[model samples]
Target: MNSLPKRIAKEIERLMKEPVPGIQAVPHDDNLRYFDVSIEGPTQSPFEGGNFKLELFLPEEYPMAPPKVRFLNKIYHPNIDKLGRICLDILKDKWSPALQIRTGNFVILREKVLLSIQALLSAPNPDDPLANDVAQHWKENEPDAILTGKDIVRFSVSEKMDLGIRQAKVD
Candidate 1:
């Protein structure tokens, strides 16, 4: 039928055959229009070793517009709301047809965004946020939280390993 769903299915199939590195997108079996995406956390970021799941929906008017993407995992970042909604220019205000959502393109975008998110986690931007409370908390109480190690969850996997080793040595 070459319907929107069919076209998306075709794209998904092609992507699966020639998978891209860093990120992946696959159909959820139950819904072809919806895709389950997993992005590996970028290195040198607080989210390293953290695998994030996301839901991508291809609208009927896709190709002409950007697909709807939302995180299914909990993430603490300036550009991502507590609910996991991303606030990227490409996903929101600056989407264009020139941007194709192929497997390669998706992987690139995911990696780039994750890098930005890592930077944001290190230095949050509360000027614009989907979760105002999170932003406010970062702005008002970040220093105290850092001092108390309250908001720190061992962001990096290597950091966790190092901490474990140090504790083992002390013990």
Candidate 2:
């Protein structure tokens, strides 16, 4: 693998030193720009108690362009599509080169990508949604939609656990 950019290397080092709560991002041995991320669902949300796996890739453009992040596991969210594409402003037009990965009670209110994604899970926006059907479900019957999300979270977690066990046995 080629050497990582200085900026990316610093960011990764900082991330390792001062880790964010409820979020873990580890780089691949071969590719430092690619991260295997896992975020625990926020409490009081439908996805609570679930560990959502996601992949984050820092492109050549890097801070000039937003990192590409998408869920690797199933998630029932209005802002998230079937393909795990997230409909978040920061990931798109709102992206800024100055954005960092810090979270919680910072002096500046600058947006942090992963933290913003976690916040989105806590407060979903049905009006602007990637998953039209899920958004409609949220708009029409929010309670039912939340219940469905909870069900999906439960199932997804269990399925992941089972897969882990099987892999462990194989190993």
Q: Compute each candidate's TM-score over C-alphas.
A: 0.64, 0.88
- Residue ranges of candidate 1 with Cα displaced over 4 Å: 1-10, 101-125, 137-171
lDDT of 2 at 36: 91
Q: Write the per-residue lDDT of candidate 1 for residues 1-171, one digit (tens) a residue.
A: 244455455566667776656667776676677778877666555555566678877677876677788877666665677677877677777877555445655433333433444345455566777767666766788665333222233554456589999999999
lDDT of candidates 1 onward, in order = 0.62, 0.85
Q: Which stretches of candidate 2 lie over 4 Å from their true place?
A: 101-111, 161-171
Candidate 2 TM-score over all chains jointly: 0.88
Best by lDDT: 2
Models, CA RMSD each: 7.0, 3.6
Candidate 1 displacement at residue 47 in angstroms: 0.6
Worst 10 residues of 2 by lDDT: 102-111
As a whole number from 0 to 100, the lDDT of residue 22 in candidate 1 is 60
Q: In candidate 1, which residue pairs get closer than 3 Å at backbone N, Cα or C atoms, i.e. clash?
A: none
How many pairs collide in each candidate, listed in order? 0, 0
